[model samples]
Target: MSLPFNNTCRFNSVFAGVLCTAALSIAPVAFADDGSEASRERALVIVTSDSLETQSMAMILSRAMQEQGSDLHLLLCDGAGDLAVEGYASERTVAPRDIKPEGLLATMMNDGAKVDVCAIYLPNSEYEQDDLREGVGVAMPGPMAEMMRDPKIPVYTF
Candidate 1:
């Protein structure tokens, strides 16, 4: 017999939590660099989701990785591209947490993390580089391609 829909949803929620926990636990170990040429502690975070939860998680994770000596690059595309716009208001994702994703992104920038929106974002959205917040750039194809080809750097997507 099939379980009720709500029960199935609950089960899925629990499963997703388990997966998130497992992924977090494994992330550092899997990406740690032992000062080796082949394994540098660098990360590329590609965020295509504009949803508050997803962007918040990406920002949080990227900051954590930076704290661990990983150089981080945040590439925003699709819905997430809106995040790079200057003075863009962000919806709060976590309760009892005042900082929104936009604030977190600023903090990350202050920490020297690179932020880039897809090159097409501006043209397609009728935006220009000057329309973005300071320090945010358009992701050029050449550098983006190079980043992807660097096997030593791991990528996290949200």
Candidate 2:
């Protein structure tokens, strides 16, 4: 017996998730720094959530990491990509400092964070590459996947 087309797709997605989780679990751990040499921690922060609180928290945590000397590569997808769009402002402000996600994003970029939107963002959205703020780039899947698979560079998704 075979699953219906939609059911097959759902099954494939779930199976792929399980395999990826298993592979990650077995991948050898690589510390960001070794006593013999000095190296900053590298991280890939992927934010695809549309929720305001989620977006805010992602940026907050990323900022914390950067201040600690970690090298950050931000991959903004879905609605979160708007944070890179020039002249775009978030609706609500977050607590503790009363800054929105876009504000934190700007601060990180100023501090030399590498920020990029998923390549599909521009084509699907009403924005163009020119719409993005200076220093922001579009992420290509090949390079983004290489970052994700690098054991030394941990991936954090929200």
| Off by more than 4 A, model 1 | 1-40
- The number of the candidate with the highest TM-score is 2
Where's the lowest-lDDT run of ten residues in candidate 1?
A: 32-41
What is the C-alpha lDDT profile of model 2 across 87-145, one tens digit per residue?
98888787778879999999999998999999999999999999999999999999999
The whole-model C-alpha lDDT of candidate 1 against the native structure comes to: 0.87
Q: How close is candidate 2 to the true structure, as a TM-score?
A: 0.75
Model 2, runs deviating above 4 Å: 1-38
Highest lDDT: which candidate?
2
